[model samples]
Target: MQKILITCEHGGREIPEKYGPYFQAHQPLLETHRGWDIGALELYKKLVAAGADASFFSETSRLLVELNRSLHHPNLFSDITRQTAEVEREAILEAHYHPYRKQVENAIQTFISQKHSVLHLSVHSFTPELNGEIRNADIGLLYDPQRNTEKEFCARWKQEFEKLDTGLKVRFNYPYRGTADGFTTHLRKLFPDEKYGGIELEVNQKFPQGDKKNWEKVQQIIMQSFYAAVK
Candidate 1:
């Protein structure tokens, strides 16, 4: 059997009370793409409600500690938190980062033990334009091309999404590499390819940043297309 698991690492831009002081001077940065994936949580919620086997999300601002990034990754701590004391940084990781990733890891382990192949979808959003370059795809399906299961699933998902009349662009591994140092990449090492399929579903911020109704419609189309691909 195949099971679906959803996660949204950069769901919200909420700064914890203890960490508020560190981010006070950088409030504007937190409001930008550096803070969080704006519409990711909303789309994640829709997927969960549409019947994902399990789901997890961190609303804490990535500026505090990026949940999507691995611990040793240089970008795990944003510029603001990087200046904090080492002990305090460890405390932040203990309180926020480790717990969320551990929970998802545990969940995947449990499902694999039950003889199920897990399709782990990590939802994220990208700025429509980054570093003076405009992103061409409306949706990016990221998966390690070397992993056949992950690659095939993304291909099918993209095909299904493109069939919709929504006119949204869908591409594989844009804006960022699927094999990059991220939560999904880390998990791929812990589980065999046959047992785990990790894909990062990246949506362009333009959709959610625009009119509300159209955003909701986009969400519906995404959810519907996923079901079709899964079938």
Candidate 2:
């Protein structure tokens, strides 16, 4: 069955109205990569076009609340300023974070109820170099090793991605290890063992330049690789 679902949490950096001017004041910091996960949304769209049912967060900026990060993560917010007054922060979490999570949960439930095999592809992008250290891998397939389903998916993706472009480096569980926590945590717990499988696909930023053309290329690779893995 051609069943698939996709999502991208750090797709954008849209600041809420109350915090808009404040972020603008610190334009340099707010516009940096820290504010958004650069290029993730575009890749999600590609998956959608390739026949996957894709759900995405529409917040104006990730600076308000990082939809991808665990709600308890300390640095979810860039910094606390007057713009992030107590009331504003509460509202941001209530409106942005909760709704996005609800959407993901609902999608998972709907797919399972329909008796279709589900592949929850969480799309993400990472900077090639962090703290001045170069990241040599082109892609990272994150999956909890304890889960046989995730382990098999990750292994298959690694092989398929390399076949698409042998020069592109592909690794399993590098940069960050996959675990049943954060957004994927919710899905893993909600769905039954055999019906659902989740994979956090992390792409290095060197290829996708946050532009339309480059985004298209990244999207193509993801869709193709995902199709191959599922097969």
As a whole number from 0 to 100, the lDDT of residue 151 in candidate 1 is 93
lDDT of 1 by residue, 1-231 (tens): 999999999999999897888877888998999899989999999998998999999999999998988888999998889999999999999999999999999999999999999999999999999889999998899999999999999888888887885488888998789999999999999999999999999999999999999999899989999878887
Quote the lDDT for 75 in model 1: 94
What overall lDDT goes with each candidate model? Answer: 0.92, 0.74
**Worst 10 contiguous positions by lDDT, candidate 1:** 158-167
Candidates in order: C-alpha RMSD to true structure? 0.9, 2.5
Error of 2 at 100 (Å): 0.7
* Residue 89 lDDT in candidate 2: 76
lDDT of 2 by residue, 131-168 (tens): 99888787888877877888888888878777776766
Q: Scored by Cα lDDT, where does model 2 land?
A: 0.74
The candidate that wins on TM-score is 1
Per-candidate TM vs. native?
A: 0.98, 0.88
